[model samples]
Target: MARNRILPIFVPHWGCPHQCVFCDQRTISGCHRPVTATDVTRLLTEALPLAGQGAEVAFYGGSFTAIPAEQQQELLDAVGPFLRTKAVGSVRVSTRPDTITPETLERLWRGGVRTVELGCQSMDDAVLKASGRGHGREVVAPAVALLRQYGFSVVLQMMTGLPAQTDESALKTAWALAALQPDGVRLYPTVVVRGTVLAERYADGSYRPQTLEEATALGAEILECFLRRAIPVLRIGLQPSEELAKSVVAGPYHPALGELVKSRVYRNRAQALLETVTPGSDTVLAVAPNRVSLMTGQKRCNINWLRQRYGLHSLRIVQEPMEDWEIRLQSSESLDKINR
Candidate 1:
């Protein structure tokens, strides 16, 4: 199968200035220790044989640009040989919105970094402060502009249901991020982890994470906004890992959260399409094979939804022969007529 090979090197909280109220990087990242240059080199050596071309070395789980210059260079230098040998295609890293600077961008460029992802959690200043993000939305705008000026692909990461965040604020954040013209975005709804202040608040009834259904609906809205702007949403939820699962105190956490959101979007689209058909009319719906699961929804939710909304008890869903995102619908009359 064709894939964009990525070797994720987790740098958990290496240069984070403060522990955000909702952050326990070690738990969320599933890596408890900072990765050293030696560690990176060792990992690369072991991974290179298995990694073909088109592999990217990704530095994740911390504000990479905020890390000390010497340490940053050490890690970059360790990956340099692999890049030169064509074992790795490019470098990508994630950092806090406030961490980008001229010098930081220059260093990253020199190190052959091609993509920079910013953790711009929320655009509302109150929400940012409440979440202990240490920087406001104002900080992300210029950082995004500067990263673009430096010729790097920029990706903005946003969160919903953060402390002091509302549905309006979340939508506003998405609009504001769209204004920046980022090449990509990642939408992560807040998840309360053990040992975090958010978890304490959850215990005390002072905070609540968005419900799975609520989050999926919100994420669908956000996805539509970005899709309209032609911005790729690289991710939609926190990736599930054993360590991350262990750290969760409570919240809308799902191993297949991204798939769930996508399925919700598909169901919405399917419903819209079904609306064009006459009520109580039987129809057969065909979609791509890969999308069959999504169109069907989890445990036939989509099928049931279509049945209820369109009042069609004899709806049939089939996999299309050779198409993606192409759906064909036929009534019994058409099927009979075609066969005749």
Candidate 2:
């Protein structure tokens, strides 16, 4: 796996016609000023020296292809010098599913863009409509196919806890997206920002954002689905920013949201393994040293849950050199009956 260190340039809502109910692009991207070719050049000038060898120059925070052709070319052209000198590995752009066309893809490929991330926020049309995303469920597949045809690595971004969205809907979206065979995926649980329609809905009781617990539980399940299909989840939650934290009015906003989600995954795996253990018996869970915190969970949530659920008199999680997801039970008593 190639490690990515992105030099991100935010073109804040540059070509988006309608703002999604949960989005506040300016707040999310922390860039309120308009971006121009000159701006792109200056951004690269500062970022290139610090970027990793295969670092990507990412144009994010809006629909890139939906922007005017001239503007798009100007931004793409600005990165040409860096690409030519190998200062940057490749260019990446995020756009809406409906914005892509064969012509645009060819243009993107010609400009040295290697990755295209589509904002396929939902697979359910009702969820899309309620979230104010203009594109429907039908557009994502064809867009992904087109990107793949052009040899561009496809990454799909999906949202959870959106207006009128349920866990089943989110799961369906995950399976549908996985079936597309995208190179990567980004999972975002909706947060009601101060100025978006979602905030108003939350204020008026029309929408109820997921609590941290709810978000982590659902996010963990979604993460497991992608992992099972061998699709890398590039991002587990929105990037934490001062702007986002300040602007968020409600929802599952946590600085450690990604870690929380991972801990939940470990918790689930532990539960499955513990189901075979004798109840009311003490047990010790040995996992990799680096994964001790994950196995224990934040505030020992996993440990506490396992004890209560399995009726274990005492549950001990320790660190030992072990393979990833490899849980070893060490016990002298009848608790040793469980096997991985």
Question: What lDDT score belongs to each candidate, Candidate 1 first?
Answer: 0.87, 0.89
Question: With candidate 2 superimposed using the best TM-score fit, by how many Å does residue 244's alpha carbon deviate from the native?
Answer: 1.2
lDDT of 1 by residue, 75-168 (tens): 9999999999988888999999888999999999999898998999888999999998888778888988899899999889999989899998
TM-score of each: 0.94, 0.94
Clashing pairs in 1: none
lDDT of 1 at 136: 71
lDDT of 1 at 197: 90
Instruction: Please give the TM-score that candidate 2 achieves against the real structure.
Output: 0.94
- Local error of candidate 2 at residue 328 (angstroms): 3.3
Once model 2 is optimally superposed onto the true structure by TM-score, how far is the C-alpha of residue 273 displaced, in angstroms? 1.3
In angstroms, give how far residue 186 of model 1 lies from its true place: 1.1
In candidate 2 the C-alpha lDDT for residue 224 amounts to 92
